[model samples]
Target: MGTTVLEEVVRNYRGQPEKLIAALLALQRHYGYLPEPALRVISQELRVPLSKIYGVATFYAQFRLQPRGKHTVCVCLGTACHVRGSEQIFHQLRRELGIEAGETTTDGRFTLEVVSCVGACSMAPIMMIDEDLHGRLDADKALALLTQYRD
Candidate 1:
């Protein structure tokens, strides 16, 4: 992890403390995850402490300390969705994506996440691609849905 991306991102923010989050986000986007080397680079570039950087990274659900895929698939595990077969949907996605929950595909094309709820119980067994919702999903439907993003 060189300092190039971190340095450029911090430079764009003019070293403002308020831009720390944004800078981290940009850095993460560039590198996929905030590795220790990158975090050290960021800390030095922004003149912020390593502890603070780690704190921010760990505090946010959106931040990942490990690599992630290009597209993230979130399946709802809320009571209603579970009752409606969200588990089967999750299993289908795992099989198709070839990765378990919280893991990214070997090709780095997709990541699977299981959330407690997506707040679309009426459309039980809902799954999300990025932020778009697909409701009333099952194994076949989920497989078809994922094919659209495979490329």
Candidate 2:
């Protein structure tokens, strides 16, 4: 293709130390995680310390230095979600996937994480499988939803 996403991110924000956070976010978006090589490039181009860049990356929950699975499964454990039996759905997912929260499956197809909220309280007991929002889920429904993503 054309210039790689990392190249674009670096070139667009080259020598702009103040834009480090934005640059890291852009790189994360492009690759789903921050690749170490990209970080080195950012350090060299932006003239910023690699330690500083890494500090910012580790400070934010949104950033992932390691590669995430193809799909991210976020379960809402907010007050409303908990009240609506989200734990039951979470249990189902854990059982079916054989992985607990904060762990990825052996196949690298799914990563299960628990979040405080997805900001959709009205649709409590919700989970997000990638970009799709699934609300009003039960044990069976959660398992079925996960099944479709295996492909």
Candidate 3:
């Protein structure tokens, strides 16, 4: 991120340690992941420890240290989803995308992940592509939906 922009973000939350999470979140939004230089700037400018900053970043799943694909595919493995065959769907996606869970496709088009639940148990056996949820899916149906995001 540009120093000017980073400075502005620090200025917005200057002297407010409680807003550390918010500042980090804003940086993540801008850069797609928390860049080390940005974190250092935040630590120095905000007088917070670098270790503390990293602690918070690592504590939350929302923060990503590495670059991510343009899209994230989350397969639910909750009890209801498991019973409905989400595992098979997940395996199909893994084979088709050539990536295991927590891995991004070589083309960076998609990142595959497994989540415990998305709170849509009624729509069990669901997989989410970005923010859109596709439910009641079999292996074939899940693969079919991938066509829409292939590009």
Candidate 4:
């Protein structure tokens, strides 16, 4: 049987057991998240158990089982943010994106998430899009932020 591209990724590791993380990262780089078939191929190619692969993937916050949207929107709901009406901002985002917390839009354009604190309370009511932290926002401004990301 021919090795799949996923198995080819595992082979790139050259069978070094210590390269498991590297191998998984390579796979994720190719396909947004760790696809199920790739995981199985990795297990077979590296002689590593599928359970261990899942364990490692889940242990790292950087790894994701589900595909992420082009944009990741995280709203901070810390006390400072909440006091500044972060809840309203979050709701506005949900309405604008048509996606509830932790859900990606059907078109895979955006993902909405809520975080208790992002250590940016000084900014208060912050919404982070990808790596950009947007603070001191009103509901309208927050909704407006989505415009630049729209197609």
Candidate 5:
């Protein structure tokens, strides 16, 4: 995002440094991730150093620095999922997508990530694509599920 949309967001917060996190959040919602240039705009408008702004962005896991993919693949790694072989499923996804955790595929179709839990222990060995949760999966089954989303 350039100064145009970001400026509007900053203007909403009255350009207050105290509102940095809130401003960043609004921007994140708009762009899906915090663009580097967008951060510069926030720094200048709020009179906060870019380094400090970066600190806040990186400090929060909710803030993403890179662009998000069309689909997000989050593999559950909590104790319940782990015992059921979530790791194998995660590795298989990484291998198939050719992108490591927190990375989007080259085609920008998918992003792979690992999560501690999703509160569905009964559905052990779970991986989610976008907002849909799939459970009780083996590595092969996980790959098969991904195929459905390829289109």
Candidate 6:
């Protein structure tokens, strides 16, 4: 809605080409998603081409061109996790978040994603809250884990 953060970030960008990624990261941190208007503003402020900006955004997994949720829930769907009931975990999260894979919640509180593996096979059926991994999840355990973040 406002342009203060965007302007401030553009002002801090050095002339170096490498600063492009840093600038995008700052924008994402401020806005949660890279809106088209914001992208245009960034291009104008930095004097960088729009194509370059789009390229940088596309290159990075962290930069979301679309909206993202406040909390990201990543469930591992690796072989071990699958055998240990990760599908059930995925279902539970989808039902609780009210959004399918790669979607943010209506309230913008949570985003659900399924990853191929999280490397916690011993504790299969793991879900990560941001970077913190919770392992050995059953339906009840998963539900309880989600409750901790609910308003």
Tell me each candidate's TM-score.
Answer: 0.82, 0.83, 0.87, 0.86, 0.93, 0.85
TM for candidate 3 is 0.87
Model 6: pairs clashing at backbone N, Cα or C within 3 Å:
none
Q: Give every collision pair in model 3.
A: none
> Over 4 Å off in model 2, which ranges?
none
Off by over 4 Å in 1: 1-5, 12-19, 29-32
Spell out the clash pairs found in candidate 4. none
Show where candidate 5 strays beyond 4 Å: 1-4
Q: Positional deviation of 74 in candidate 2, in angstroms?
A: 1.4
Question: Model 3: per-residue lDDT, tens digit, 58-99?
Answer: 999999887788999999999999999999999999999999
lDDT tens digits, residue span 78-108, model 4:
9999999999999888888888997899999
How does candidate 1 score on lDDT? Answer: 0.86
lDDT ranking of the models = 5, 3, 2, 4, 1, 6
Candidate 4: residue 114 lDDT (0-100): 92
TM-score of 2: 0.83
Candidate 4 weakest ten by summed lDDT: 10-19
lDDT of 6 by residue, 1-151 (tens): 7659877787788454567778888888888888889888778777789899998899878889989877789999999999999999899888877889999888988888999989889999899987778998887898898888776
- C-alpha lDDT score of every prediction, in listed order: 0.86, 0.91, 0.92, 0.87, 0.92, 0.86
Predicted model with the maximum TM-score = 5
Candidates ranked, most accurate by TM-score first: 5, 3, 4, 6, 2, 1
Which pairs clash in the backbone of model 2?
none
RMSD of each: 3.2, 2.2, 2.3, 2.8, 2.2, 2.7
